[model samples]
Target: MSDAPTTTESNPYLRDPDVQLMLRAKAGDDAAFSELVANYQSRLVSILSNLVYSQETAEDLAQDVFMRIYRSKNGYQPTAKFSTWMFRIANNLASNARRSAGRRKEVQMAGGDSSGVQTGNAGEYLVKEKSALMPARQLDKSEMQGIVLSAMEGLNERQKMAVLLHKFEDMSYADIAETMELTVPAVKSLLTRARENLRTQLESYFK
Candidate 1:
């Protein structure tokens, strides 16, 4: 789907082909389930990897996501877009894993291409790079990634997840709210606070 924002006249969720494919899977089409898994595997792993911070764990969690979906196919419903539903499941699973493990120490973000980076196209990086107060030496990609990832780690889990869904997925506020089990206003508030926290944390990089 085009990431471009379009009019809501057409309910994008209902219009998504993946939703139809999921419905087919719900109807006991094993091949449809395989196709759904194929279509989402990489994307799911990418998103989960950032959340969980381990490609190996992300792959395992993604497999678990598919397993859950497959097991509950009989009760599948289309209340939201297939991707949103899938991601909601992913978010919950990640949150549970984090909570279960307890007190995770902060780690530097690594791995993944720019496309999978949750920070969004280099907009924030450009702003920092062009700042008058920036150090004379240009920040390389690794430095930028470190700074961005550090700032992201400063956010609360919900704030971080909200930023990820908003920036990486290009999801509408409504869709994000649906995926995160939040109200539209709550999503907006979460993002506002998240951006403020990031800006504060990254202040040294800016003017």
Candidate 2:
């Protein structure tokens, strides 16, 4: 009997449709590549915008991510889900950008738009349990969104990234650990600390 594992056993992530698409792209299927880009472009931009706090910079970084993916297509492997692999690339790029730019100033969430990043359910995700503590005066959507954005901005970089992945992407701790190149326990710790920080910030609003 052969000692080598079967293909599916060796790379279970190959079962993912996106991973199939990526494999097709690696085989020089341009349409498959375009589909991957179309599917993930906005999502990448949204995540990067939250990380860098600039729509323009996020869009630019997203393009760079795709370009790197294209350049490395021949070397692509299906050991992880496509999104996990892509976000791992994004995490590294965002870290590099942050380091190159030094300290970043906080930007307020603009009116009429949440700065091109959807705050979808983030408020609920962060503070649903504390809803009863809120003041009797109901907060409008924009006001609550601003509060959430400020709380997100208050998190340190890794914590912010971990929270975004957990809430926005619905990634589990193991997936988050793979994306961020951290151990699962470390990812859990980051999220635990992030939730506490967010709770503290939200409590101030409730007060």
Candidate 3:
């Protein structure tokens, strides 16, 4: 009659559907593995594209992420949301790529899209406070998108990653902290500074 909760009871992420799919993947279910890939491929590519600033590079990195996941399937653990685990891999890969490259450069978006990512709700999030940033005049969608992309570029790598996870993934601060391997408070501070930096950059465009 112990009152303590079991591991599964304690970790609610274990109940996530993606985690169940991954568990099946770990059990050598080929279809399950494919399903996981299908589920996350676009999201992975989109996030990676923004991180690396190149569509081609993003695609390659995304493939690498899947490969890594496949190879590590036997050891898969449901410690967090599957997306959080996946993005942790992505964040590391992007950081390593940047370190090896040793320079930042602008790359054109695929299909003329600003920010070079799927950017789910990110544009909307950016303009939620539009009045403050563009007091002089109203910007059309294209113009606002370009400014948002530029503002995103102003952030450092960590801040950009945090913001992307927050806005695009709609991840909680706790999940983001785990994905980024930072404390919760640190993630909060990082996101706060990221928003401030973005606001400053966007305001400069109107000024």
Candidate with best lDDT: 2
Clashing pairs in 3: none
lDDT of 3 by residue, 1-207 (tens): 113232677978667899889889888898998998999999988787677656567788889889999998887767767888899999998888776554322333223323323222335534443544565455676476757776787789899999999988999999999999999999999999999988887877778
Highest TM-score against the true fold, candidate: 2
Q: Candidate 2 — what's its lDDT? A: 0.79
Off by over 4 Å in 3: 1-7, 103-140, 204-207
Give residue 5's lDDT in candidate 2 (0 to 100).
31
**In model 1, what is the error at residue 59, expressed in angstroms?**
1.2
* lDDT, candidate 2, 70-114, per-residue tens: 888887877778999999999998898876554221233232322
Candidate 1 residue-wise lDDT, 88-141, digit = tens: 999998888776444232222343223221222234433543463356475575
> How many Å off is the CA of 32 in candidate 3?
0.6
The parts of candidate 1 lying over 4 Å away from their true place are: 1-14, 103-139
Task: Report, for every candidate in turn, its global Cα lDDT versus the true structure.
Answer: 0.75, 0.79, 0.77
The local lDDT score (0 to 100) that residue 83 gets in candidate 2 is 93
> How displaced is residue 27 in candidate 2, in Å?
0.9
TM-score of each: 0.73, 0.78, 0.76
